[model samples]
Target: MGKTLVIDLEDVILEGDILDVGEKNFGIIYNISKEAEDELSLDYVSSDTKIELKERKYDACTFFFDLNKIWTSIEKEKLIKEISSYLKEFGEIFIWDINKERGKVFNNKIKVILPNEKIKEFTFRNLNVLLSSNIEEIKKILEKYFEIEETKAWEDVFFIKGKKIGTKVNEEEKIKYEGTDYSN
Candidate 1:
C-alpha cells in the first residue's frame, strides 16, 4: 500500500518549485493516511529523506481568492461549500494556507480597508484571513465534505489534501485531475 501511494503521487507538481527550499509556498506531499490494519504512515519527505519522489505532473487549477481579500469568513466558507458540491466523490482538493507558526513574517504587514465610507489600512495582517487557515478549523469544515488525507506545514505555508468521501462507490467511478498540459 505504501509503494502504491508513492506511485500514485509520483506525478503531482504544484505551482511553486518543491525542490527549492527558499520557496516557502510549496512542499512535498506526504501519505499520512492511517492503516486500516497495521500499515505505516508516510510523512512528507525530501531529497535528504529516506524516500524521494522522482516524477511530477501537476493537474492543478489554482485559485487563491474567492471574491476578494476583504470577504468575510462566512462568505468564504459558503463559497468553499458550494464549490465542494460540484466535485465528484473521491475527488481531491489541495489548498495552501497561511501558517500560524510563521506569523512573524506578517508582523510588519498592513493593508488598506474601507469601513463606513472611510479608507483605513487595517485588519489582521492585511489579509483578514478567516481562522488564519487554521488546520483544525479547516478540518471542521472540510471534514463535512471530504475525508482528509493529511495536513502538513512548511515555513510560511501549510498544505492540506482531502479526498471527497462519497456515500457509495461504483466500479466505474473515476476522477482525474487535469493540469494545464493534460491531454486525453
Candidate 2:
C-alpha cells in the first residue's frame, strides 16, 4: 500500500494565499480551523491535493510551521494520542516549526508578501503562536510514540523526524511521557 501522509493547510502549504512547495505534492490536507477550511480549495491548490475531514489512518504525517497554532501542551498530548490511534504500527511523523527565539533574529530577512489584506490578517493570527512556543515540547510529545530518527535546525526552522517504535507495554504506557509536565 502507498504511504499515507497528512499536512497542515495554512502556514505549511499556503503562505498568505499562495501555494507553497507542499501544494505541489500530494497528500491529505488537514485544516484544524474552520477559517482555513473555508479559504482553501482546488481552485488554487494542485489537483493532487485532497482535503480530509474525517479521522483516517495514515502512515506518515507532517506538521510544518507551528504546533502551538494547532494545540496547547495538554491538548497536544491528546492530539498525539489521537494520531497514534490512527497511525500504522511502523508509521513515521515529521515536524517542522519556527524556532521562535532563533527565528526572531532573522525574521526581518524573510519576507512573505500576502495576496491581499484578508490573507495577511489570517497569516498573522495563524502564526502568532510561533513567537513564544518551544518546539522541544512538541518533540517530547512525539517521543512518546516514536523513536527520534533525526533532529536539525536550519536558519529559524527546527525539524524532527521520528519512526514509530513498537513496545510490548500497554497503550497507556506507550503514550506516557515520563518527567514531562503537559499541564501547560
Candidate 3:
C-alpha cells in the first residue's frame, strides 16, 4: 500500500542559484494516512547549531537581523537516505515547503534538501522544469521510498502564503521566482 508523505519545509530554497544548501525552519514532518499506515514517527537527529548575524544596508541605512539563526546542516545524502529509507516503508510522500514568517526580508531558505545528494547547478527555472519535465526522474528516486504519483507529488512539494496563497505548479507562478535569481 502507498502512504501519503507530508513534508512541511521552510526557507528551503536559496534565491538566484536555485541549487544550494537549504535550511529548515523547524523539523520536517512525514505524515502518512490511515489507509496506508496507522502510525508514523520521525526524530531529527541533527544537532541544532545557531549563528547570529546582523547586516546594515547603505543608502537606506536599514539593518537586517537574524536573531534565531540556529545554523543547521545535514549531509544531503544522509538526509535523503534516512528519509527515503523511512518513506520506502510507506505510501505517497508529500513534501511541503512553507515560509512561516510573514514579513522578514530574505527569509525563505527551505529548498536546500537536494544539495545533500550532490545535486548542484540548480536554478529556479531548471527546478521548475524538473518539476514539470523531469518529474519521472524525481519520482523514481522518491519511489525508492514512497508510492506517489508524479502529478500529485507536485502538490505536496510547493506552498505559498499570501492573500492568494497556493502552490506554483505552473509556469506562471514560477516566473516570479526568477526575480531573485539566487544572489542571496
Per-prediction TM-score: 0.41, 0.49, 0.26
Better of 1 and 3 by TM-score: 1
Full candidate order by lDDT, most accurate first: 2, 1, 3
Q: Largest lDDT belongs to which candidate? A: 2
* Rank by TM-score (best first): 2, 1, 3
Q: Which stretches of candidate 1 lie over 4 Å from their true place?
A: 1-72, 100-131, 167-184
Give candidate 2's TM-score.
0.49
Each prediction's whole-model lDDT (CA): 0.39, 0.48, 0.26
Residue-by-residue lDDT tens digits, candidate 2, 1-184: 2122222224433212222213321222233222444654322222353343123445565554535454457877775665555556766666656555423322222222222222221221223434444568778888877888888765555667777767547655756756678789
Q: Comparing candidate 1 with candidate 2, which one achieves the higher TM-score?
A: 2
Model 2 regions more than 4 Å off: 1-56, 101-131, 167-184
The sequence of per-residue lDDT tens digits that candidate 1 reaches over residues 15-94 is 32121211121222321112111333322223363233223312221222112232345665675565454444455666
- Which is better, 1 or 3, measured by lDDT? 1
Q: Kindly give the stretch of ten consecutive residues in candidate 2 with the minimal lDDT sum.
A: 115-124
lDDT of 1 at 119: 26
Clash count of each predicted structure: 2, 0, 30
